[model samples]
Target: MTQFHAYQNRNPASRERYPYLLDIQSDLLGELRTTVVVPLCPADLAENMRLSHLNPSLEIDGRRYVAMTQELAGIERKRLGKTVHDLGSYREQIIASIDFLMSGI
Candidate 1:
């Protein structure tokens, strides 16, 4: 999968709060066949929190959501559903979110 491509979460149990997940893994690692994803939570829950260092707010399809960078993980390609949004424009913010998650800065 291409980096920064958003995918719809097919897991019904977790879809209500996290309807989308952003793939941060690069295409160069396609051989691994697994995607590293960051779950996106609804704005209401995200905005009321003070974890900006880890959860960065972002807009997807006009609705605001926070990228749960701390929840990053690798999952099988089949676990991801249809493409939801392409987060190419938010590349810098996404990267910064990840950097803060990893480095705490």
Candidate 2:
């Protein structure tokens, strides 16, 4: 379900069309974890990074600390992008897949 594979499944149109779906998928996954009583999944965490283009910073005793290097952010972004694109029927069956992930947590 890489972006290339997603592209192969749909019309050869601009990314604007599919990026929204990606956003929607990402947002829903995020909201579910933050608002629900259920546990978060690795996939949900991955999608959060993809949609937000940001990864978690450490927060020990309520003090936040992010990597000072920009290259770290770039590396995380690339990793998340590849992960989101690698899933099966990502948009169509996101919730079910997410539920499975939640159950595993």
Over the stretch 53-87, how does candidate 1's per-residue lDDT look in tens digits? 67767788788888988889888988998998888
Q: CA lDDT, every prediction?
A: 0.86, 0.25
Q: Lowest summed-lDDT stretch of 10 residues in model 1?
A: 45-54
lDDT of 2 by residue, 1-105 (tens): 222121111223522222211222233344232211111123323343332212223222233322111111111222222222323333334343344344632
- After superposing all C-alphas onto the true structure, candidate 1 shows an RMSD in angstroms of 1.3
Cα error, candidate 1, residue 30 (Å): 1.6
TM-scores of all predicted structures? 0.91, 0.20
Considering only N, C-alpha and C atoms within 3 Å, which residue pairs clash in candidate 2?
Answer: 1-85, 1-86, 2-85
